[model samples]
Target chain A: MHIEFEFSGGYGGLFAAKPLGYRVETDELPDEVRDKLLALIRDSGVLELKPAQATGGPGPQRDVFTYSLTIGEGAAAKSFAFDDASAPPAVRPLLSRLRELAVEQRMRP
Target chain B: MTFHKCNCHYIPPHVLGNMAKKGDPAVRQAARTSAQQAKLSREKRGVQAPKVPEMLTGIAMATAPAPVTAAREVYDCQNKWELRVKLARGEGDPEFGDDDVDTVYGYAETVRGYFAELGRNSIDNAGMNLRLNVHVGENYMNAFWDGDEMAFGDGDGQIFTSFAQSLDVMAHEMAHGVTQFTANLDYYSQSGALNEHFSDVFGTAITQYKLNQTVDDADWLIGNEIMGPTLYGEALRSMKAPGTAYDNPLLGKDPQPAHMKDYYNGPNDNRGVHINSGIMNRAFYLAATDQIGTQKAAKIWYHALQNLWPTADFDDAVEIIVESARTLVGDGVVPEGTTQTVRLAFKEVGLPS
Candidate 1:
């Protein structure tokens, strides 16, 4: 499975100059890494996470990041956006992996 | 009152979290590390030991004057997440040789002076110890008031810089502490916006007071000096024109709306607390500029703040401020027309009393 994702929200949207986004496929990774990533995603209940509305309540949670993820594409695409402060335990690994991919994508020449 | 633990942050989580996604390897690593540290901070909260009950060491004599003075402690996180790791400076320590430590110390004292000038003690209005942790994480690009203390980050040196370099930024975090002690506005919607509003207000006020600048002579920009040279933005936010702080290639246009009609109803940004704050900020600016000036306007708002509750929204703010104006005027504190000027100011921002 391939995942498409985007993340934003920070000091006045500074990092958002270009959102980190890319497609990550299992075949593109080393065998063990791919297996670990896939397993983490599968078990993390990322698919069950309901879409989180865009809102970071003021107070302690101010300026927190928000994420949008799509497990598939086109009409069959399943997308969800969530606040970083409220990321579920099962979804954290996926979030971490996506961030890693996004950074790599962003650094491309 | 329960001293609520607040995750007060200088750099919004989204900003730091984004660094984890799309920067150079070092940037991404720092971002990820800082994010993890921030998360761990929450867990640390759970494990925090309850404060030992205050020991009754001695009783004060009635003839002795009560001693109340600012007490401060500055710690160095040493580019790690843990707070209070190494003692860097203290209230009366000699120069620590670190610009971050010395700068935060000076700024904190200035903020303390601002409050003391108004007869308010420290964050708790009872001279609570001021605690700060600097160098929070490697390339960390934010600072915040984390409920009991303040945290500063050494910026990534590219997109952002050290948070300690800016007095207004430091004052902004200090102002957050003030709100926690005063109205303690809820961190949702309008209340959150108001919380941000007061911080911005005092942030600018302290800056102006420090510089000895008249209202008109002030720049009215927040975080302009500390934004570093990488970005083309002028400042983080502008009080004179809310949405006009910056419009750069990287950060897009400022999203703040000066009127309720342009209020942001989107997600993240704590229900646009920082964004929508432009409205109230502009209102305060207008009121302060013409009718009452910054000093009186600050006093009026400070009074209104004391009268507010956690859930007070924009409408409630209008009512409380107008009432505060009346009370201040009735006591011959401020001249007449203060209330009218305030009402007209809010009305201009679509919040009529």
Candidate 2:
């Protein structure tokens, strides 16, 4: 499986304007990292969550990160959007791990 | 870490009544059970509900008497995504000895005191309590105002640091609460930008006041103190010179526009709420430096902020701000020609565009 992640929008546009992005192929990763990512993905149940469930509720949430994630590739790819304020409890671990990978990879435009 | 769970005791009877009437079959049954459980819990605690009309009960709940003085509550999240996981300290409590908690507590005091000087009781001007959460998550890199309270994150230590350490950041988030209670600006498009602009205005003004720095003495930069080693000396935005705060490979160049001609009309950042705010910020900087001073300039802006309504755009802001400056000038709060100075400052930034 392939994964793409982006983190943006926060206080003072520090992380915004130019969002941090990363793309990784599960097969290309070391065995341990690949297993962890796969585990988190399974735990997230991202494929099953509805848009309303994934996104934040109504009302203003200031200075919080907005996240975009995609899993798989081509026709099989699935995408999801959420923010730090309203990410579901089950989906948080996956988002945290993706953020770590993006920062470690130094992925940017 | 202690895991706080919501039980029947926390649900108000009015909410339970509505739920029992409107919820689905399973939800209705659960609501009824919860209501019964709540009554039992109240009796166990020796708390009794007042006998009143149903509508009056809701009114009383909604208008629950506010505290005469606001209190501060700081929670330690223990590097988890959850908030208020552990009570680290409360108002008048001894320092927790944790740097993050201690620093945030002090900053909260400074913010509360500053607002009091402006004749504001608290965020709601009703002595609303301040709830702050620190160490929010593992390598969390942001701080936020979630309408009711504020939360800070210990950054990854590469691109940012503990947001709790910044006084201006705390004041900025708290000002969002003030905006919420006052104008209640919609968080999108132009109105959203005004919301952001007012926060930045208060953030800088309060910081300057706390530091005892004049307009000439201040750097007029936001988020400069939070930058970690990798991005040291690079700020997130510069009110004095918009679009010039930062330029680097990691975060790209700053995208703020100081004038309406270069305004950002993109769909990103909630229609450029943070981006377009630079125009207004520059306008403020100009007015402050033109002898009116930051605090006085802020007073005018605050006056206008209270008068603004939801969906107010840049043009609406210009008219209201100028009117506010005029009113302050007439009252001798600001020096003569203060209104013209404000108008000229807005013209310099291409406001009312």
Candidate 3:
């Protein structure tokens, strides 16, 4: 499975210059890391969630980070957009894990 | 029968009745007396009951149940994504001894008092309660205002620190509530940039007011105080000099544009709401340093904010802000030549574009 994650739009536009993004292949990860990422994706139920389920209606929310995630690619791909207020509980752990991975990967030479 | 001064005679009977039933004790007594006087006056003249206009009646009722004071409510999220998970503090309660909780409590008071000095009751100008949540999630690195309340995150301890530790950050979020009630500027394109600009305006204004700092004394950076050890001496945005706040590998360089010629015309950030705001923020900085002073310039901006509409653009803001300055000058709130000073400030930033 290929995973792509992007996060932006927080207070102070912290990511305005360069939004945090990551693309990783599950098969390329170490066994432990691969298992953890796979588990988070499974627990998130992202494949079953509709786009509408990721948003909490049109309302005023300020300075919240917006998240975008994609799994797989092309015909098998699933993508979702959500913000801090709209992200469902089940999706949060997956988002956190991806964030950590993105930071770690970025720091790697 | 002696007639008391019916100060509320113009108020419709139905509205006054509602106030009598629902108002605070003082308002209730006054409403009752006013209602009785109105009835007696009608009977004395043998006049038929006057028909109340629906709009007028609505306004009366809406403004009747006035909030006497703004209360503060602080919640601890306990590292959860959920909000208000636990009530950590309330208005007038003893100190919780938690730094985040106590710090936010005091900052809320300062923000409330700052607006109160301007005759604003609260965020809504109707004494709405202040709701805040701290410790939102594990290593959460942001803070936000979700229409009705605010939430702060303890940062990842590298690039940032506890967001609740910064007064300007709290004030910035609270000012969003004020903008929502006032101009209600659309959070896209120029209007969105204006929305962000107004929050920064109040954020720095309230900070300077609390710290007794003048234009020269203030650092004029938005998120400098929140920088953790790794990013110390850096900032998120620089109102004094846009696009110069920071430049590092972790967060990249600041992308703010100080002049309209360099305005970010991209689709990102709701059409550069945060990016384009640097233009206006620079205008404010120029005006403040040019003898108009920060608080006075803020008053002009606040007046414009109240008169502005949801879709108001940059040109509209410039015109309204200048007119507001003229009005304040006439009222002796700001000094003479303030309108010209404000116009020049905007001109420097390529405003009214």
- Model 1 segments more than 4 A misplaced: A1-109, B1-44, B47-69
Give all TM-scores, in the order shown: 0.71, 0.85, 0.85
Worst lDDT run of 10 residues, candidate 2 chain B, spans B1-10
Error of 3 at B113 (Å): 0.7
Index of the highest-DockQ prediction: 2
Worst 10 residues of 1 chain B by lDDT: B54-63
Over B23-111, each residue of candidate 1 has an lDDT whose tens digit, in order, gives: 79767755654554444444424333222232122221222233434577889878764568899998789999998888888888888
RMSD for each model, in Å, please?
Answer: 12.6, 9.0, 10.2
- By lDDT rank, best first, the candidates go 3, 2, 1
Ranking by TM-score: 2, 3, 1
Q: Which ten residues in a row have the lowest lDDT in candidate 2 chain A?
A: A51-60
lDDT of each residue in A1-109, candidate 2, tens digit only: 9898898788867555567888989999999999999999999898788766765533556888888888988998888888787787678878989988887787433
Alpha-carbon lDDT of model 1: 0.72
lDDT for every model?
0.72, 0.84, 0.84
Error of 1 at B192 (Å): 0.8
**Over 4 Å off, model 2:** A73-76, A107-109, B1-68
